[model samples]
Target: MPLDRRQFFQASAALGASFALPAPLLAAEKGKERRIDLVSSAFTVALDPSGASRSAVWGFNEQLPGPTLRFRRGERVHLAVKNELPQETAVHWHGLRVPNAMDGVPGVTQHPIATGGRFDYRFELRDSGTFWYHPHQASFEQVPRGLYGALIVEEEKPPSVDRDEVWVLSDMKLDNQRQPVEDFGRILDIANDGRIGNQILVNGLVAGSQRTLTIRSGERLRLRLINAASARFFRLAIDGHEARIIAFDGQGVTPHPLPAGGLALGPGMRVDLIIDCMGSPGQSFPLRDLGRPPATPTVLGALTYSSQPALRSKPLASAVTLAPNRIAEPDLAKASDHYIIFQGGMRGSPVIGLVDGKPSRIQEIMAKQGLAWTMNYNAQHEHALMHEPLLHLRTGEHVMLHMINETDFLHPMHLHGHFFRVLAVDGKPTPHREWRDTVIMGPRQSIDVAFVADNPGEWMYHCHILDHAAGGMMGTIVVE
Candidate 1:
């Protein structure tokens, strides 16, 4: 269904609330012990190490990027979300298999959790891996303003590592006063990157050294990297260590053992990695970025080293065992190609953002009750007409996408409903091939991602920049 404007607002009004139950009680185990409470409210906090001024916005229980809710596979998980915001908010469980009503999508899967009201979300933990939760109402505004958290469903067994850390990355816009900047009207500029923020924060703090963990020279570390940003796409790297990507978007994959590459992460995307420390004892290994200029690359966190011990260590058990059900890959002749050009902004200055070829406006959005802003040139959200014919395939046919980034800025193109393989980047197959949900495309660069459209729905493909997406940089597909 297209985005329903009035319905969204109506749902928001109905679900807004304040206050939360106790945390320990929320997570207290019953029978076998399994429950959690995730708090949602506005906050005044800092993301950079300089510790900037506090701001106002929605957060989980007054905390930015709320609590990390962990559970074991096959267990019954209960979550009580207490909304403390002045406006309505609901938590959407991204990439989880549960009853539709527990999905936390306001006006869609379930009703919003009204202000001063509470909702009990109970579901069977059918799958285990990295997942996240965030508001779905006014998604452009709510999510960007800091309403997200990590939801890790641990497997009966887990991956081997000396330590496991969950990292959530986000961006923010603040005034000279260091307060969160709020201008709902300006956030919908079809002529510019919608909601592009000036400040970057990791785990709810700005780029600054916070905690230091001790690691040995040969110790294996696991990093669960999650992109919960409302708009920004991040390219992440760590200095002085070799890391291997073992999972994505919450599911384990065929382990492709390779050196760590720059992670192109988008909103709602997750990458699980195993790293072997090569630095000497007492040295610090910083998780740095080889990010391009204008997009600063800095240390998200650091790992301090301890003297190596003589005793051999045992690896943590694998989180998952069964292989994922993968669809066949498409060959060149058996696949189809499509072209999407992000057209907007003045030619020389690449700051202007556009979907397909048109600019979006609120008046335009309000005019269509069921229409949403499409990111590509297509007008109908997810139903844009292509310059070429739609790619047709059998029920289980393999499909390849040749996605080109025509603009100067970066775009983390995400495909909902299915994971695809990075077949080629700029005309070559990915060196160490792996399945990915979001592929980052820099200006003038192109990438080929293939997947079998097995699980059918109105899948979306667009830039992960929430601002760009809200301004009309999105489209959808339907499989019959």
Candidate 2:
């Protein structure tokens, strides 16, 4: 059964309402600094055009899709979050390499901010790219209720384009009356695919299905695509056009043409594309999800050309290369190898796992308000967010992690505070080794990633599947 609003609040409130300590006292550093005041509250949104079919959702500053926060590459951000919701909430700056204190995981990094409490987050932006922010406490509920926003870190020397736009993609489960359904924390959903929504949204509008961008022929565009959905994986393609994938997960990569099969964006992932309008005037093209059923290819958006002659008969001739961030390459020859295995999630099989250094079973965990998932044999209970580190490493150590998935589902694993190079999958070396903050692990798959632990702090490594992570598939890495 779905949890009622009061029950959801009770569960979120049980996360504890302790205040976080003040950010480190550092001199107001020089750089582009800005103060952003964000308030979390409930708002009514019109999912349909009639305005009668509205959904009550939680949002930042009473606006769905919150606000687009823009910053420069080396700016200092001082963000103050005022919680107006009925329960506690904290924001995690997804994909940003902020200090450990500003990572925003309740109990693990900081305490949850209570109702009507205000928390200040101060951090310096190191790398400029596409990132996002959302509540970390009870995210399985808060995020799905519409509490996420886009964060853009402008490049020092950005590429030239007619327009630079951000497309925040999301999904929501709705009832017959167009109201958001309340089936959060269902056991079956937690064990299987985590909360796949029925309706797809782009920038908080159902109109995304038919939204059109008018452009002149031969004009160049820069599109920043963010997958903010809780669990949905989007396989997208732009019909009648070719897009060059320049960046992934906020990290710049060697520019390459997107595959004909399209790009796959899992939860917590981002992709940057540079595309040129090639279609003739008065012609229209669609940006669609190819993974959906043939009868219904989810049309994310459209591109319509104006009645103007082409600037040049052919596409843009200039070759483009993005500036790479300053990240140390892993020394694979001297890398220390480690393994983290995923287990459980069987229908009839018993979930035998460990919770907080104690032996526990699936029934026991469920009875205590927990889900059935684990990483390295450790399952975190609902009330206890902080757990011992899975492994401790010294700074500058290059290590290889073999993430083995034994379950029957896909898990997009995300590592905070650092990006890792994907070396191999299923023991097969990759042709183009790429760096990513989040890697999708398929069923019964084994992926090997190498990274240098240069960041000095306790960072989180967990499944991007919010429900699974909340259930127990989360751990911390301590680099000293």
Candidate 3:
């Protein structure tokens, strides 16, 4: 069946009478710090229409995609994470520029919280935009096993709209019994396109017309899209509607229309869209991901209008721009330039690299070390307790990172603790030159990004593809 047309993909009632997403974990009060108790453990849930099938998942507060933690900008938050899983884990606040100790890369920032242990993450929210949290220890396995959540910090006076929604988009490789397939971090998968998921999810439910966004005609919505998948890039389009992008990776940007083809959202990224629903009452439009093959999109969900009369005859005539965060702009004239050459992959050029600091071929590194990727010709494996960061800069230095991708695979590169201006891709200046904590690097492409090293710490810089991270495409950056 062709999903692009979506004639058979109406938002069904099979999921439930009202398939509502889990509400925000808790709200905040003015002049007061918000605190929450988050527990990570394995639980069972029915993932399909059949009540007989249940999936064992690891989630926070017992909710897959965890709880939506919403807070006001500048509010202090105390999140106490208790790990009930057998293995150790730590929570990383994705895209948040917090103090280094709270960044949450187990070996880099803090020690992994052992089983039956609790770690208190106390930080003050300095910026407001779409962000997320997930386990940093063995993330290649933990994230895909249902351990991630949205963390939203609202601006003091955000644009007025009918409603706000958060969608955590992810995918899982499920087995016959609807359980997660356990194959993780295989060299073959790590060196290729990473381990692609078999089942797509929106807000923890199997997507494809099961979930819906209900709206009244002429209503406006602020949709926050988070890609929590281990490795899935979404090229999305809204049928019969216009959605202007207001933010990327939690940083405000000039409202822009859909790119020439579609909006490409890679793993570990977020997009804030301002969608004015001008559809007629009782009509529905499909939100599709065209990245998958066969010229057919996978229906992520639909925007359905209710039977009530239209809220207005025309779309709201108001600005939908977001206020910018206080990120220090890079002084390019004084910024120091650095290079990071990425090499090795299943289909990449044959190159000689290091294994345990000894010279070796890429093939030998994969066959003997269970690793398949390299950053800067160094064999700094992810399983190590300590390592030399790929780049080091003095605190408060402005630096430009020129990342070269020598492999034949798309890598969504994610940098923790700081947002960089994407100056260019493939040697061409970006129109917006948007600030992002994560950006996609095309095969054999070059990207230039610049950021101010204002936050001092050892930050994890790695591929958002979890398997690739496990297979040694991961490293750390230090500023001191």
Candidate 4:
């Protein structure tokens, strides 16, 4: 039977509602500054197929999901990491700018911190917002199982809020025995969409529950949402309350009212929203994801109002009209737009899809490298350039890159070391003027991103889905 559009939505909603859960973990307090000592050690934990439960690892601070390292912007950040894992490892301060040497890109900036090694990451917090850290080596595996955490850089002049909560949404793939499913870098790509799993989780639990909180009416609350899933894009919304979007990807932005409709969150993307609880005095407002299926409740969590005196008529603070960072806007008129098609399937069979007109052959490459993993239709092999695309631009030239999605799933396209503005969609002007480091492209859809290649380096442009990236959705752009 063909799936009706409405019926499809209903089925998806059912999948979403399969579970509702209580807030899974304890949240950190506002205005608290602390030091962190993280030890990345290798250990084994039990796993069902989905790899969702408390599995074994190689993790930071000896725990999966690593340790939550909290610090205030403008304050000194002291991170002492000790590695006990068998292999050498390095921590890349994803989305944070410290120093080139301290960037921790393993081969690029610093040497890998070997087993029983200790390294100190010391830097001044220049930005106040949400960020995270994970291994730079084998990041594809380390981050998927465990070894990642929230690196919240708090604002010096905190927002006028009574409380704040940080939520990291992720997914897992388990085997039939309910243990973490693993291909261990040998699975055929064409049979599945890279490393996507069957189980979905928010901060480490299945859906169909609630994360409850209490706040006085009229008080302001900040909700920081991070999509840490390896290969999922989230459409997040709060049930009854409206959330004003204040930032993206850790950079503060001009505010936009949300919960009027929810927002889309890509992997490596972050949104900070402020909600007022005094609207109905005692109403229960759940933060929902209208983007998901109806059967599956979109409620990320709930914000309950306490019986406090309502300030008759109080309005939330309007967005601050701050200029974007001091950077020159690129001239789009004279700039060139590049079109890159994301296409592939089984490795050696020569399926029709190719990135720029070249098929990715797993066995061919493995024969050259003496490896065992052969490419299936979707082998994550390198989709190299026949000739490097001319990407270098004048320091201030504005250029648009059109990404066309030809696959069955979503791809969170990300650019390293720089950010860009969304100029249009399918050739039409962008409805929302938001700047981002990563943009999620849906099947059959096209997106245009504008950016000035100001930061010069051999930076990577790839799918943020680590598995897809490993299979070959990876490339580099040189900014001269």
Candidate 5:
């Protein structure tokens, strides 16, 4: 029998509720800054309703998403990472601007911590926004296996909200047994869309048992959505509500209504939404993923109103204002213009390029690393996290990059430690003029982005596609 819409939704809810919901990991409490220990080790997590089916993976503190490390802007964080896994690993603070020596890129900033060894990461939190931490060494394998967590830096006086929530979105490839598929890098996958997973998880919860956010009618919420996926780009919408975008990629922006179509969140990107629950009491609305196919919109979670009387019938305010960060506006007049071409992938015309300063062919890259991607005709084959700076600049210099995408795929290019003002897309200027740490580039398209070289350090810039980055689509920037 064909399933109707109601039946389909009921089935989905049943599937989600069949498994035991894991206890939510609490964010570190606000207090004096002190040393925190995180252990990287192998663990088992249930990805299916059966509960018997578990995937063996590596994680921090043996938790699926580790812990949510919370801090106030300007507070010092001292973390000691203990590696219990067999191989070496290092944590990269995804969007924080820290001293180069503590940046956590193995071999770039520091050597990887060997098995049973510990490394201390001491840095001051400078930015207040949604950021993340994950293994920079062998990230293609480490991140996908589940060694990642949310790092939230709160502003001194945070916006008034009934509740604050962090949603970290991720996916995992699974086998018939509901175990994580062990294939890390297939040439075709690396050359194309990276590793598209078969199962999606929201804050470590699988399909059936994803928690619902319950709120009193007319309550305001601050939802921090982090796209922790290796490659998936989320086109998200909340049914029966409007989400005012308050921030993007850890930087506050002028509040604006989320696009009617949806908010597109690329990998490694974070979006802060101020949502007012206007629905009637006892009603439940879905947070839908419109990016997936039309077969069924992926219901990430539900926003259910409390059974109590409604507080208000309308939204709190039509416009919400947020204090911007200290990021300097890009000086477009004095910006030095540079163009970087992205080429190579599966199904595209073959092109020869340099891999680690040596001339190489597409086939050679595949043979060497099962890679199928390149950035600016350079296939990054270096095992270490460090690479020679692709662009070097003096501190505080304004730089504009024209990233031309020649590949026949979408690449969410991400720059570490700093955010850039999006100048234009495909030659047209952006109306919002928002700042972002990651920007999506479509096939055969070009994007002009400008940023001040204010953070003096060696930072990695690469495709957010983990497989593609591992395959060679990565570079570094040096600001001195």
Candidate 6:
């Protein structure tokens, strides 16, 4: 339900009221479990709205992007995932604080849901923010084949807006017949910038100016943008509207206008934006992907105003700040400092990288082992039996991890089970110091992030570029 002015204020006030319900009664009501059956099977989808051709896809619940799972904060969710496809798969809740066993990396945390098998994932919603879920098993192939969806945890006191929307931004590589190309896990793609899809998609359909978001003038919208692409990055900008970012990767942050270069959403990242429809009636504003060539920016969609009169004479004056999640801040003075150097890609020095148990150079491994990238001078395959974790810390240790990217390719590194405060970018202090679960690291750049490792378990830390993880940019952090 949309939070109107009255409900918004009441909810905000309820945050301070402790005299409402008894602890046992409140726990019983809030802990009421909701279960849903999620099935992954092979289906055909016409990604092009014209229905030129249908692409064979493997998605959850017969949908390209799967069903959007909604839950209130503190609610218990039981996801009974049934695997109907021929291959094994497992769903990973991208940004939620699930138990170590429920983290969903096949073979690492729990066994993959085998073909024709079912896995029950039960967890409580500990955070209120926009999140998503996708297959962690062979993600390079599964994700592009259309197996991802939004997971929204409604805030106790959300912003008052005309409407709240979620846009799952993704891409797909297709042939002339609109069939998905089976050339996944290629060495060339893994070695360089991960494989990029030709067709950009917004919620399953092809994204273009035809994909429109209708609104009335002088209305405010809470737009949650999620990037579920394998490797694509969206540097987005609206033609005539001002978009202020309210949160990053679901965590609340100080509301602010878009940075000078617009919003850069890397793969597996999410951003919440507050867009005020100040346009005139019948006007349309194109949402362009500026990351492409400046000569011709790709219009992902358009924001068009209805023919009706303005909703109000002026924009909504309600505060856009979101309720922050429960995350422990890192004390820099006592936090242990660690460094991870990212190496190997298409172009780099003739460095030796560990492949399996043997050391191999970049050139030889791609042809023989289908590996391309390395972390800390070692390359690891997903769910590999011999792989070792990158970092190990006590259950509540404060860690200041400095990630040094040496390659010439971009990597959106994602850390599971925890949101870290981005302390610095390229050795310089960040202004907002926002918290994010997934962060983009530029070529030859260094990023310093600090967080308290309070979530005890073995967590995967890998590049969000699915191919890169299959290549070698995959590792785990152990908090015991």
**Highest TM-score, which number?**
3
Tens-place lDDT per residue, model 5, 1-480, is: 133435533443344332222333333433655556778889776664446777887887666676677778988778879999989999888888888888888867788899989899988888888898898888888898898888888888788787788888988888888778888877778887888787888877674224578889988889999888887778888888878899988888888888887888888889999998888888998898777456366888888888998777776764456667788788888999988898888777777877677878888878885767777777775365445667888899999999999888889998887889988999999877888988999888999999998988888888888888888887888898
TM-score of each: 0.73, 0.89, 0.95, 0.75, 0.90, 0.92
TM-score of 6: 0.92
- Give model 6's clash tally: 0
Instruction: Report the lDDT tens digits of candidate 1 across residue range 1-480.
Output: 122435533443333221111121134567764766666777665444354456676787556667667777788877778877787777777766566567665544456777877888888866777888887666677887888888887766685566677777777788888677776425334334456567666666665444455677666777788888776666777776656677877666666443454766766688887876666777886776545557656676677778776123543344423245333565657666655555433222323322334554433452442233333434333223342222334456667677766556566776655567877878977764666667777666888877776654344455666555554555555544
Pairs of residues clashing in candidate 2: none
Candidate 1 local lDDT, residue 122: 85
lDDT of 6 at 89: 98
Best by lDDT: 3
lDDT of 3 by residue, 1-480 (tens): 112212211322132234455556563443476777777889876666435777888888667677788888999988889999989999999999899999888877888999999999989999999999999899998999999999999999999899899989999899888888889877788888888889888888888775778899989999999999998889999999889999999888999998858899999999999999999888988898988456568999999999989888888888888889899999999999999999888886797778877889988998888888888997556759476789999999999999999988889999989999999988899999999999999999999999999998888899999888888888989899
Candidate 3 off by > 4 Å: 1-18, 27-31, 49-51, 292-295
Which of 2 and 4 is the better model by lDDT?
2
**Model 4 vs. true fold: TM:** 0.75
What ranges in model 4 sit over 4 Å off?
A: 1-36, 42-58, 72-78, 98-101, 119-126, 156-158, 174-179, 184-192, 197-199, 205-208, 259-262, 279-283, 289-295, 307-328, 333-339, 346-398
| lDDT for residue 144 in candidate 4, whole number 0-100 | 68
Model 3, residue 276: distance off in Å is 0.7
RMSD of each: 8.3, 7.9, 6.3, 10.4, 7.3, 8.0
Each model's backbone clash number: 34, 0, 0, 53, 3, 0
lDDT of each: 0.62, 0.80, 0.86, 0.61, 0.80, 0.85
Instruction: Kindly report which residue stretches of model 2 are placed more than 4 angstroms away from their true locations once superposed.
Output: 1-32, 49-51, 207-209, 292-296, 347-351, 356-369
Ranking by TM-score: 3, 6, 5, 2, 4, 1
Of candidate 1, the 10-residue stretch with the lowest lDDT total is 16-25
Per-residue CA lDDT of model 4 for 293-410, tens digit only, reads 4545455556776677765357566443223443446568866787777654342233342323455344453334222121122223432323353255555556778887665556
